[model samples]
Target: MTMDSPIPLAIVGVGKIARDQHLPSISRTPAFALRAAVSRNAEVDGVQNFTDIEACLAARPDVKAVALCLPPEPRFAAAITALEAGCHVLLEKPPGATLGETDVLADLAREKGVTIFATWHSRFAPAVQPAKAFLADRAIRKVTITWREDVRRWHPGQGWVWEPAGFGVFDPGINALSILTEILPDEALLRAARLEVPENAATPIGVTMTMGIAGGGYEIDADFDWRQEGPQTWEIAAETDGGLMSLTGGGKTMAVDGKVVSDEPEAEYDGIYKRFADLIEAGESDMDMRPLRLVADACLLGRRVAVEPFHE
Candidate 1:
């Protein structure tokens, strides 16, 4: 669609993220117009709302694209419905529950000639690209990621996060992985991982992993926990031949050798929507699965330690 005439877009799952980020970004972006919403328990004002994706697609035939913001477990089916209906699709972080499901969706998108974007919103942080550019030519010696937050503060009553495939701590941990994957010049390969799962929960509440570059020069150590209180930490640092490069504030700020280079307020979702527009305009899909793959690897290779039961 032309810039002057924005593409009619619908959002499936008008939950926390939809209300907090997607709606605001959509309102500001000229590339898309909010046309409809599909949510079983929520609705977007000033837009057509449907309780089911099928009903939304059947009714809002004019909608050219849809953003799936639901939990990973149920996202694949909603994305399939959107792609099958000839609508470009945007998938929220972690893509789908399984890597196989994402591949299937990609194949279907290709068959339907529709753009499908598996987005890692953290990668869109303002300082991320600059960090990537800085690290492109430097020899990375070691990378450290410390991502800790209180799930109760971020997720609140979201019980689905502790279920099977809910990802638990990995849900936020994958954000760090996305930034890591984006900034590293070479592919990062997981070496070992330890997961601390609550005795009563299916997913881990904390994760510690070691990874190395595919070319075998550098190493990465990542620690993710959902037990931090008061001030949260989302920081990544890379020690390189030149100096130490730090990305903090969830990638909104960056520093090199203790000197700040780029520090900006968070507007990652805005960038995400803009990139989605660009991908649709170019008739292409961006379904990077590296971050998700790393999580999958952890699940496959990680040593699970049963910790105390987690209570909200």
Candidate 2:
């Protein structure tokens, strides 16, 4: 699409993520023009706003694509509707509530002959590409990821996070998994997992998992907790043949052999829009479900433990 004649795009779900990331990125990138938005309680400045996805799609038939930034539990149906309407779909991270749902959407996209991008913005971080390239020829022996932050500080009164179908700690943890899956040398499976749920919540507040890689035999231990105090920590460190490769500050900084290599201002959503533009141009889908798959597997097989009740 030419710069003047951008692809008409609509956003389903005008939540916090939609406003903070999707709108800004779409505005900055020339690939897409925000045509409409669907939400129950919000509206964009100049774009058409609807209370439902069907109405949005029906009203803007010219919208060739849609971005679903709502919660994962309600994402599948909207995505299916968009794809069946002959519009490409861009899904926010964690794809769906379950791995099965994402698989279903993927199949539906194929049947409809439209693209479905399961976007993991963290994977598009500036350092991730270089880090993946740096480890192209190395053997990774171990990996450790520690993602701890205060939920009240970041999510403040988001009750859905504590629901049964909602992923809770896995919400942020999945970002780490997305980065790990992208940078790892081989597919990995969770060998063990322990989830600590607050007494009053349906979802866990903390989780610890151990993952095993294929033939090369690499182990990854991850800890995700929402009870951290003071400064937050989001880091992934891997021990490989090329010394130690660590991604600090949530993939914004990269270090190898105790020496800082690449550090840049965060622009994950910008990169995501750029990639979406490229995918639209190439007429291809860029959906990867491995990270979500791992999360599902962990939930399916993990042992649950009760903890103190959490209060917002």
Candidate 3:
């Protein structure tokens, strides 16, 4: 493709997130042209569909970029294939099943001179950068996160969420961590954690964590649960020397000192694709592993408490 033309792109995985977020964002972003898709059981109309990534890549050599929307467990191999074929890659949140695998992908991308973006969609939320600006000059004293949502309403019949490496409640909790890592002036390190795992599941359904700022003067406490039956809650509040800044509605709204400062509609995926286009143009990669590292630390240093089994 020419520099003035939109980048030819392919999307792998046509699941709910791909349908809801990625496809729509790509449609609106003029920098990318959807050329193909790869999915075992799903297809997008008006686009060439393949049953596998290799077939898609081989058939569409002109497609210079790919977005992987599959689960983290299976993303590494696809990312490797895309990068090896000299294609820019945009990975969904949490990048891969492990930090090491993401690192390998990053190295391969660098070697191949292609861009690989391990995106945290929450960081692209409208209110996040505003909150980051608000906290940039203040001394944060404490942070509290409450991210509780009903899995049945959001995930529906997705049983892989309870499997090992699926990340359970942390699937949502990492969003908060991503925001924290973006906005905080200092690195946040995990101190201790408690994980409430379902008796029959391999992942935790509930978690409580304590983290300390690397610069030493503040602490963060977070509670995550996947069993809220009614109205869901996704909020993060930080008490700084300036005032209390609150980010609610999953970073769609922000309030400081109990006053609403920023409120806007969700456009995270759009922002993500915009950034990806920019990265491809600049020949750079954006992959922040802090959020995933915190999750790994939580699992490593946490105390597991087996709770009642969860059923769909």
Candidate 4:
């Protein structure tokens, strides 16, 4: 709340997601000044650093907001601490270990009179809005999402992704679901799902889910895998009575009827930061639990199959 200064903000969890996206987004957002980093494994240049969120809050009273990019399990507590300290919060997606926890955090934020922005970054992908517009009121068809990437190349040595709370392939799968829900004409419900869990890992390395669009019997399928070897793919396509609608390149590209409609460089995190700033300024909260709810429902309906042990 320092006049003439950007809103002081602290970031918790300095992982790859933070370093590659959140940090740069914050640096470019004129509404925010990166004031502190709370992470034992990472540090930010010229910013105060702490091993944990409590210490960061204790040291930076001027910081009015916190952006948490930690694993979903720890994020619940970190968000609670920030809310208790009178700080607005921005939460990276899949906000908590369970849908119930996310609901609790939203209630707490309201009770505390603080805003919470539970970010679903993929919803900001440049082509998503265009795709949404294209599908509005003109849908009676099927949707398929294929999201695949090599965990070895992207996650590298990250073993936590295999932990129960890590959410395995859903870590990236949720991104697809986010975009799907953003563009689709109606709410989605998971009808059935199959998870391919590695014997050595607690979570699935791959998943296939069948979802039902509200008000229709359209088939919606999403396949996500962490074992893809080459040419990482992130694409979603729908067949409608009008034509084919597709979003490729993690929603950076949009096409209709096999013709490109929208294509642009992605600034998902930047868009998220801008939205967070706007919500904070307006004294409002923007929370969406749809994407995560679908994931939770998928988990509840999924059949788990044990695969061979995996190793990096």
How many steric overlaps are in each model, in order? 0, 0, 0, 0
Which of the two, 2 or 4, has more lDDT? 4
Candidate 4's C-alpha lDDT? Answer: 0.90
Error of 1 at 137 (Å): 1.0
Segments of candidate 2 deviating more than 4 angstroms: 1-4
lDDT of 2 by residue, 1-312 (tens): 334578899988887888888899999988889999899989988988899999988878899999998887888889988988999899998788887788888888888877788999999787898788887789887899999999998788789889976899999999999999898768888998999999999999999999997654888999999999999999999898879999988899999987999998899999988888788777678778888888888888999999999999
Q: Give the per-residue lDDT of model 3 (tens digit) for 1-312.
A: 235989999999999999999999999999999999999999999999999999999999999999999988988899999999999999998798998998899899999999999999999889999999999999888999999999899898999889987999999999999998999888899999999999999999999999997657988999999999999999999999889999999999999998999998899999999999988888889988999999999999999999999988
Per-residue CA lDDT of model 1 for 21-112, tens digit only, reads: 99999999999999999999988999999999999989989999999999999998899889999999999988999999999999999999
TM-score to true structure, per model: 0.98, 0.96, 0.98, 0.97
Give the poorly placed runs of model 4, Cα more than 4 Å off: 1-4
- Candidate 3 wrongly placed segments (more than 4 Å): none
What is the per-residue lDDT of model 4 for residues 129-203, given as tens digits with 9 covering 90 to 100?
999988897855899999999999888888888997899999999999999989988888888999999999988
Worst 10 residues of 1 by lDDT: 1-10
What TM-score would you give candidate 1 relative to the actual structure? 0.98
